[model samples]
Target chain A: MMRLDNTEIRIGFFGALAVAALATLPLFSQGYYLSLGVNLMLYAALCTAWSLFSGPTHYISLATAAFFGLGTYTVGLWVDHVSFPLLVLGGGLVAAGLAALVGLATLRLSGVYFVIFTLGLAELVRQIVSWTQTKVSTRMGLYVFTDFTEVHIYWMLLALTVAVFVTGWLIGRSRLGFAMKIIGNDETVARHVGIDTARAKILLFMISGAFIGIAGAISAPRYAYIEPPSAFNPMISFLVVIMALLGGTKRLWGPLVGVIPFTILFDQVSAQFPNHTPIVMGLAFLAIVYLLPDGVTGRLEQLRARMKRPREKLGEEVRA
Target chain B: MQIIVTGILLGGTYALIALGLTLQYGVARIMNLANGETFVAACFIAFWLFTAMQINPLVGLVIIAPAAFAINWAIYSVLLKPLVDRAKNRGMLEVDSILATFGLLFLLQGLMLLAFGGSYFSYTFLAERFMILGNPFGLNRVVAFVAAVVIAVALYWFLYRTRHGTAVRAVAVDPNSAKLVAIDVAKTAAFAFALGGALTACGGALLSTFYTFNASMGVVFTMKALIIVIMGGVGDVRGAVLAALILGITETAVASLIDPGLTIAATYALFIIVLLFRPQGMFGRQTT
Candidate 1:
């Protein structure tokens, strides 16, 4: 019953093809290449999951690391007893539950307050986990034994990325997405128009948390050993944010576009100039913010519209 | 009793740091993520002065404060002003300013790291121990505490008694009304930023005498200042001081009573609790 636009159709087709290509990477690629693919997929999935809630609602959450870490620790602690799929689900549920609680309490605060609160929540969670590790386990890190091979992990990550991408696309087209756009543009106006802004925000926040948590859950086994510092590294939150913004948060495909190039950049920078990577990344971030505030996709969209305008004018003149 | 004394003393430094953030947020409505970095930069400056030039750390404040003011003024003029102007033209200033400041944070951190390699540095000056109320306290900490209190008092005086300070307050209270009254809102914002930079730098200079620090420690201090500012309420200077004192005491108490590793977590928990119960802050007026 719904009409699909030309752009949407092309995107859907290309998206499927891209996923198929990625799915075959594990079959052909080995060792470092497969691991690189997994890493790229992991970040792409995170950027997508982050943009799902933050892009539409305009709430810049720094809690991605918190949820991801929760999922990692959940898997780390319980992998022996539970099956892999159930552990993944459990990780998602736990993160969603925490997000729901945190959202209810902090969503009322807007702008910088929300950002700071989320950052604090992440730090708090990290410290608590660290404290627990020291107290209960007497060990600095947790090791999980997984029988899955590198290819299997790659497939799992690819599957998770697909799920996240699909969820993001579906959410973008749904009524909830419509409400979120309104809320992002103007919360007061959205509320006046009979939208329950708080409920919508909390739900979306939970959904975002669940996706990131699941990504963390599946990816945890790859590392074999997880420490609190690495598990809840705040840099993940910052990188995901930068990726989402760089790709153009307005479009569903923006993050993917942003992540591919940045992941490679990150890899190269970390390899060659490890200490200077922060400086390089920081400068790049500033350049993006100052020069391309709307991001790569937004700029491309503007260019397309500009090019189309002259043709449309010619068509009008001919008709006249 | 000793823990209480130490907490209050530590709170003095926090109050000084929070004062700078409070001024920026309250007056200019810029949530400066780089506030702590400004402090760290000043500390590094003082450290360089002390180590490289053999100058006393306290004396370095004379150079540090003015340099900090100029740097911050430049930041506002070059980076923030354009963004703020653009956002104002579009009528969406709040979110844009926040993002811009976030970018500025990374920029500052990166630059600091590049300029001064990541290594822990502390100023070794006036290192002495003295007994106070039957408890040994570091003389350097006592000096830092005293300097913090003096700076806070001076800031309070400036805010209450000076004409420029009144203008800053007026702009903070209502920019449109201040503009209607022929006050230059842009100039006021720049001045506020400069003043905030000086205060934070002074706080950093004082802290350098006592605390061990590195370039990456900026975010942690920034978080602490933010918590204090929020707990004290936006734009309420007195509340910021009170909140800082409360935080210092709470951290000390927690460290002493429980595990030391849990101190930061305890403070974050308190911050969350305050956010949930009193989002406007303890001393801020209610807003719908």
Candidate 2:
């Protein structure tokens, strides 16, 4: 146990270093690539947050976007009225609270039913927004200064993304993270050991929501506008999930590691084909599910595990 | 008097849709969330045959059914077979199939857009329109209703009586054991996928006559199919049929009674309520 804990510490330290280096990407990245890096950090944060609660438990919580939309709407609503930082923080808190309530009820379900309920909830939320808009005046638009380049907002999102990653890493290494992992692998065993399964799940939901919300909040400010479709769409949820799974679910820095390359690939495809963005998304998901079930981070871990084996490993170590 | 008649007309079409979901889930035990994609695919196919080839949409149902079955079988063999272990002790998380097939949904949507454009298409061959009962139901809807009933009955017979159908059922119940019994589990699953595909293609035939459709129609049908599948017990074809009727009526009634915008919400609201009370489903086995 002690040795395992130490290993987590070492890996986590490296992860922190990597995250910090990735966060400062704008300092050196070119204009087009800088935005790509910003997107990478943001989605990585969202996916990692999603993995905290749903990934481990095998719950497949589909409402990960509820908080994201909340965050988006929160920032869109508050940007004109309050400071940007406060709006972002507020988005996080609101998303966290909403997630808490949703997780408290919906997360109690398992498997397909859980996925369906969360989908219905998202649709319900979208419809509610749509319905409310019809009743109200034409002033429902998310007003903002149209000309700002969003560079500052990008930096702000990067910091929050790094902060969330660090915080998630800390929790993931803590006793609580272990408890969640235990529950994730098998709730029956976790219960036998006296881990409060419900509480652990709720904790994950809150953590995930806050991170996703922070992402949405910061992203909305960057765009200077928010809409129902963009905020609540399953596309965003699927993208984050693909990133987390692609990077390696359950790993602290998996999202950051996964999102950067994935974003670069996505940017390249979009740059080349222009209209083939969905094709890339579709192909990315297909490849991840088909060719690499464990994901990139998963592959890395297996390689690491293989390398840790004695004399045979030493002979093969030169391959890397 | 007319509500019941209208409900039955709507129910038949919905039942066919639900049957598509049931066949995949029951036989292969796979949740093909993009089953509606087949419906959309078939619609596009029928449109192509009718417009480009000068064939009537209804007349082409014969070709479309078998063709759709082949397409469905091919997709499973190509895409899904590669993903799954297809061996004993390998029933892992099936969600990957959902994601993979869902990718197909988006891919198909884009393909259809590229090929047919985003505009709605209606078969010019659809000339028959008449009333049923007091309500102004169309003749095409009646044909769809008859087709749905016949297909459901035929499926019931197939599953219960036929050798291949039994093999499919055995695979659903125990894939490994089915493999041991020389049932050719892969072929059975492929057949199940094809059967589901054929069923939706029939829906495509009905759709071309009843209503104009486009690329985006799949989402709504997918949602409605999901609700019907949930409303009906999982893997219960009969239950799915019944639940589809319940849903069709509930949706139609809610739309007529309240705001049309609230109709989708009504089904969801009902589902949320049902989930809280009966998570296994409305017709699933009673709690022990």
Candidate 3:
């Protein structure tokens, strides 16, 4: 299992601080900027869920959106009819249930097959939601209230993001993380060493689904609407995955590194060329992959490692 | 029946699309979740060139195939190659591939949306339909079908007959041994990526004629290709065509017989069924 160290502590502390800063930005910034911050935080929380299983366990499952979509619909249905906290809980529960079902069918497959299965899952949920939305009348559809300030929801979601981060950080340094790292490293060797690869993956998979589900639940009411495009998109899952990579999957804040800049760039780009955003961002991602192979946070570690190298070598010489 | 003929013809295009993916996975042992972007990107490219240059759509294949190859090559360099290089250290092949390609997928779709609006648009090309054996079928459909078979057979021959193809096979089997045998792994990988790109474009060309596709076609094509590669078993081009035929036939048959809504569900159900029963795939060899 992988173990967290001082890096995790530093990353977590800073991650929380970033969230705290985002929560207060609304006071100083306009609605659009404040809304962007909220969007970033929401994505951060969702990305955290993605980093949990995909980051540590090293599996490719696109079902993150499926869980997210379910969570959205769950809260969308509940926000008006039920209390806020319970609505959030209901979305999370629905997401978790769906995750469990998906994991049962998916964990048996490995490699690209797992990825394809998850991708299909997202499309399936999206189509279902699209069909459902079509049947309902305008006022009676699944969308929740369209007019609500996301100010309070921002902090709440921030807190949830923190909680989820801590959960993953704690688990990242625990026996389970090590077991997963081992399984991810080599299932054959780990199974030979008596690690229950299937059980560990299933548990991690469900837990991962739960976190994304909870994020979706919170986001649905905050966003004031829920539908297939917003909820079950493959791109949504892709963002979370990329965010996890940018933050350095092994470290705690990979998703944060991925989320913050990506959102800023997206917002700024959409604002600007709005026309060529796809080609520009597509090229940007290409640039990121080609140049910054380690991602943003990963690059941070590289610089740190380089700075530490000469100092350690001098220390060794002095000792000699 | 029109459905049977259409499905089989469409299957040819599907096979071509799956060809690149199968080669990438089988030879490089890299799981590319975003490979379908090549197909959709080509669709947009064809649409743009056709509108911009007024080039004949079939003649436009010359432009789309190589361009797709280049874009896919860049994708390999930008997204997949780095992750592939790090597979040894991260021991996170599956996760890394997912995240990296997930990034690629987003960037591709985002760019597509940004460059081209989300509205569905198609190019109208007139290809007179001739009765095929006294049956009604469009000339374009026949061209697409013929292209699919030729491309599939050509790829099969490339793999079995050509030196580079042999190298690709060698890389797929064992990178270390292939290196020991003097195969340039990087070159072979680049070749595989380019080949995959070209094949996907062929499918995209066919697809552009049949349906109007925007940026969103990538994931859909990726999913359908997934079913093909899985059922076909990853390494062999022949297997891919076989799998595409089965899927194309099965899907069209089901849609013809039942509801179209069942297409995705039935396909996914088949994936689970195959996965539960044969994890190595129908024709894939068991290695790890």
Candidate 4:
């Protein structure tokens, strides 16, 4: 029931326009560019989805790999029986369900405890999946053979990215968003003010989980062969967190700014200095934490405010 | 009986690993994700010394531990001090330290990878069997266990009996009050971090005696140490030892009783259960 600000409408219009432009990318470009576009959109969706919960709440969930892996394995295990679109939906729902369960158990735990639990969740799921595979079948990995080409995957990821952006925008303006803002500021105060902190957190977490799960499902075919280790890699969670933090999670579109550059950089690092990728990634993480703790957008915002202060002071003096 | 004996032996080393983390986290107040890297680095150093110069790991520790102490102290002062100064509160400090140390983790791991290559390295030092209570154990394991216990006892005595150690514990309990009381909170934290790193590296040297290790194995050890720290209650010296033993026994029991693959999963389940029932830790006082 909130009125739309002019800036909000303008931002939305430009966002839609950008998505339209991105959708035509695959039509013009083929091999490397197309693959890179897909990778960009994949992380864009993930970082945005991660920020949806962690940005506001400051919970820092490392469970993206868990949900993403479930979504991946959902497609890997059931592509033979189910349609692709249905599998994607199933993936989101399954991940959301897991998020709800985890949120109920862990939303109360704060600080490092929550962070480690989420990290362990991925390893736990990976272990269970690996063990089950050995027991159920001699095959170590599932093949995700789909007719979908790179172009198809790119456009699908684009759609998912747009969907996540729209969802984030909507949630940002809702009552739930207001509650989350309050909760983020101080959970005890929010509870004192009669806000149901647990419910709000779980709800937002579920939404974030669903989007991430869909992103994973959409990206599964890119691998062709899916295994527990790669699907549930802890590195994915770390990358998403670093990317989102780098861009600054203050705005809905902030993660995209980080996602674009980092994806390209990662691609180059993997290709050229493949052996030193970890070193490069580690350095980047340190630089981000030390130099730009508030992220790129955040630092920019600070600079802007500083720039505007002198002008405002001058105007005040003239008026006096 | 055999399983229990093996678990106890394993748990001794685990206690040392967890103790170092407790010092770093509980006293220094930095959740050092890179703590295990120190351990791994020591292992590699031990391996190199043994293979190249024919030096015993015990002899190697004399050099490596002090080096680790100096390096970690520099790391704290150069990298983490700014973070500590800038943070407005405990939560902010925790977040900054986690991210920063996470970066350090990969940095150290990658350096180790570049230097050591992606190969498992273990040297045959005291690979012979020794009998205890009708159960067979690796002589290396027994030696490592003995070393771990001696180190833990010494650490305990220092914390309880020494003045500087008391200041470190005071800082762990309440930095603000310790500062009010004219204690150098920052200095104590830095010293504790360095000492913790040294101890962790010492544990790694011990582990290198019996356990095969590689560059990437640091995260697993870090995770295990973290679980133990949380289970025993953060900052509680006695609790961490008990928790490490419990974790060691549980993991050993799971591996022997069920599938070995499920050991990590079982560890996760136990951790989640502990987090649910006792978020403050079994031994920690409830704080709000």
lDDT of 4 by residue, B1-288 (tens): 887878888889888878889999999899998988999999989999899999988888798889999999999999999999999888899999998998999999999999988999888999998999877889999988998898899999999999988998999989989999889999999999999999999999999999889998898889889999999999888998988888888889999998888878878877888888887787877786
Taken over the whole model, the C-alpha lDDT of each candidate is: 0.86, 0.74, 0.75, 0.90
Q: Score the docking of each candidate (DockQ).
A: 0.61, 0.47, 0.41, 0.80
Per-candidate TM equals 0.96, 0.88, 0.84, 0.97
**What are the per-residue Cα lDDT tens digits for candidate 2 across B37-135?**
788888888878877898877678889899988888888888887666542223343667767876786777667666776788876553576676545
Output the worst ten-in-a-row residue range by lDDT, candidate 2 chain A.
A143-152
What candidate 3 gets wrong by more than 4 Å, as runs, is: A1-34, A78-82, A132-140, A146-148, A169-175, A184-186, A280-284, B30-34, B41-119, B126-135, B161-167, B179-186, B253-263, B285-288
TM-score chain B for all models: 0.95, 0.90, 0.92, 0.97
Which window of 10 residues has the lowest lDDT sum in candidate 4 chain B?
Answer: B279-288
Report the C-alpha lDDT of model 1 over A42-137, residue by residue, as the tens digit: 898899899899888777789999999999989999989899899999999999998998888778667567788786677788888888878886
Q: What is the C-alpha lDDT profile of model 3 across B143-190, one tens digit per residue?
A: 878877887788888889999889999988777899998999987887
Across residues B168-266, which tens digit of lDDT does each residue of candidate 1 receive? 889888988999989999999998988888889998998899899888889888899999999999888899999999999999999999888787797
Instruction: Kindly report which residue stretches of model 4 are placed more than 4 angstroms away from their true locations once superposed.
Output: A1-5
| Per-candidate clash tally | 0, 0, 11, 0
Q: Write the per-residue lDDT of candidate 2 for residues A266-320, one digit (tens) a residue.
A: 7687689755666677677788777677778788878888777876767787776
Question: Considering TM-score, which of the candidate structures 3 and 4 is the better prediction for this target?
Answer: 4
Native contacts conserved, per model: 0.49, 0.32, 0.46, 0.80
Best by lDDT: 4
The CAPRI-style docking tier of model 3 reads acceptable
